[model samples]
Target: MESLVLTIPQVRKIVLEAAGLARKAQFGIGIEAVYRIIDHLGFVQLDTNYVVERAHHHVMAARIPDYQTEWLAELCEDGSIFEYFTSASGFLPMHDFRFTLPIKKAFKAQRKPLTQAETNLMKQILDRAEREESLTVGDFENDRVEASSGWWDWRLRAS
Candidate 1:
């Protein structure tokens, strides 16, 4: 096998093209455009931040000329995209949800064992999710839980 030498311009173009942030996205192509962009990008991080706009929106704006703040939300709400942790919490193509399973498994394995209270709370949340086909902390308003526990720490492994 022969090694092909690449020039600076060639590498730069490849990086930019993959990032999509520096490329011209399909203008007026609508939200389907975000699907395509994140497909190529692997995942787009969502941040609870605003410095002009949220990070995901800002990232999209750099690539997509006709981006809307609601577009990414719509993708997730409609299940066209699902949430995953890729370095940071991000939205990814729904078809790619399975790809995050390995990450979830690894994350689960390293988790500290659940306390009895935590275990019961998790069961209540899981049960509610199954019954309602949706869940939020509001569903568990009556159940006392530690206020400081991070949402990402939900997958408490049983001992």
Candidate 2:
């Protein structure tokens, strides 16, 4: 008798159903985590496979939404999918799934720009601070010379 083989879509459906159940149960199961479980069960193969094939299988079986598919695809394509694994543990793949949303907020919020007076004041303060402390790395000998010129130099040298 021929062994029953499930197509990638069918396998993905099963995995996705399992993941949904996990989510409903608040089990925190992710697609990669599910993939690890499936891989351990010998239901899915992810070794040395073509990137496209791996991505397609992941997309079909992982239940990832269309909005997040592009990022997942990119992760797979860029070979970063493996980085999500914690160890050589086969279950690492299932925990690697992530979803990101593009934020549309303004880069700079609607706020009044700095007034010319404020800018000038800031510049003046910065200039004063810079002038007050011009950092310089002096040699140990030079530091000793400067220190010796101070009133406490004799006492410090005696110590």
Candidate 3:
């Protein structure tokens, strides 16, 4: 067997190319490009943390020119992609959906059993959903009378 050797810079170049970062617009910006990029990368970790922009959007914009943030939601809406936790929270190609089952099974096996109150709450929510043709967060009564302090807050800002 022969072992290949490469210098530090060469290895770095290879890694960058594989990650679609060796050049700008490595994949043309569009929905198709989004799918191709996700497929090639295997997974693009999702992050909700925002300083300037969300981590996931920053990633796409870096590698893809004219990247639109809405494309992610559109892909999800059309079932072209899905969000799941695989080592990390991220998006995966829909064709790879079956691969997630084992991870889900493992999580289910490892999780603590739900308490009676939690179980009842789950049943109640499920029943309500089944009976109602339409439901909204406003339908629920809670002590959240105050504005949310985190991401769930939907207060729009002036443009």
Candidate 4:
């Protein structure tokens, strides 16, 4: 039997397609499955399996093709791939720091904590309503009670 060697790019394409299909159907594609395929294709290292798995998680988030292809391309162009890799897996260069941070402080400030008075008022109102009606108010804080208070006015509007 002839041995077949699969490159990182080829495996990445397959993983992306599979993930896309899974996403469309509202299902999850296991990371283990993707790594197993990579291992089967002899692209992963036997000693760096754990590192490869971690890198796979990072790579999947990158939405990039296989690590090897990217690494090779970087090497061909830049001559050195300075990154970490598991003994059983390929390398992910440290330079490709793709994680994005919230740049706009103003935008993040919009999600700031509510004022003490506002929070107390909301809690008091909700507590009174729950006590009077013996009703459960699930996650009122998370669901934004003030914003959703107008929902009750729908009945009055209809009448």
lDDT-best of 2 and 3? 3
Candidate 1 runs further than 4 Å off? 21-23, 26-28, 105-159
User: Of the pair 1 and 4, which is ahead by lDDT?
Assistant: 1
Tens digit per residue, CA lDDT, model 3, 32-81: 78888998997899986689999999889888888899998899999999
Whole-structure CA lDDT of model 3: 0.86
For residue 107, model 2's alpha carbon misses the true position, in angstroms, by 48
Clashes of 4: 8
**What's the CA error at residue 149 for candidate 1, in Å?**
15
- Write the residue-wise lDDT of candidate 1 on 1-159 in tens digits: 999999999999888766764447733257888888887777888887566777888877777777787887798899889888767888888999887899889989999998999899789778878889966544454433655477754533333
TM-scores, one per candidate: 0.63, 0.19, 0.71, 0.20
The model with the greatest lDDT is 3
lDDT of 2 by residue, 81-130 (tens): 53322222221243334321122123235457899998997896677667
CA RMSD, predictions in order: 7.4, 20.9, 5.8, 18.1
Residue-level lDDT for 67 in candidate 2: 27
Q: Candidate 3 clash total?
A: 0
lDDT of 2 at 149: 55
Question: Could you tell me how far off, in angstroms, the CA of residue 77 lies in candidate 3 after the best superposition?
Answer: 1.0
Model 1 CA lDDT for position 117: 93
Enumerate clash totals for all models, in the order shown: 0, 6, 0, 8
Q: Write the per-residue lDDT of candidate 4 for residues 36-68, one digit (tens) a residue.
A: 333333232223235435444444434323324
Better of 1 and 2 by lDDT: 1
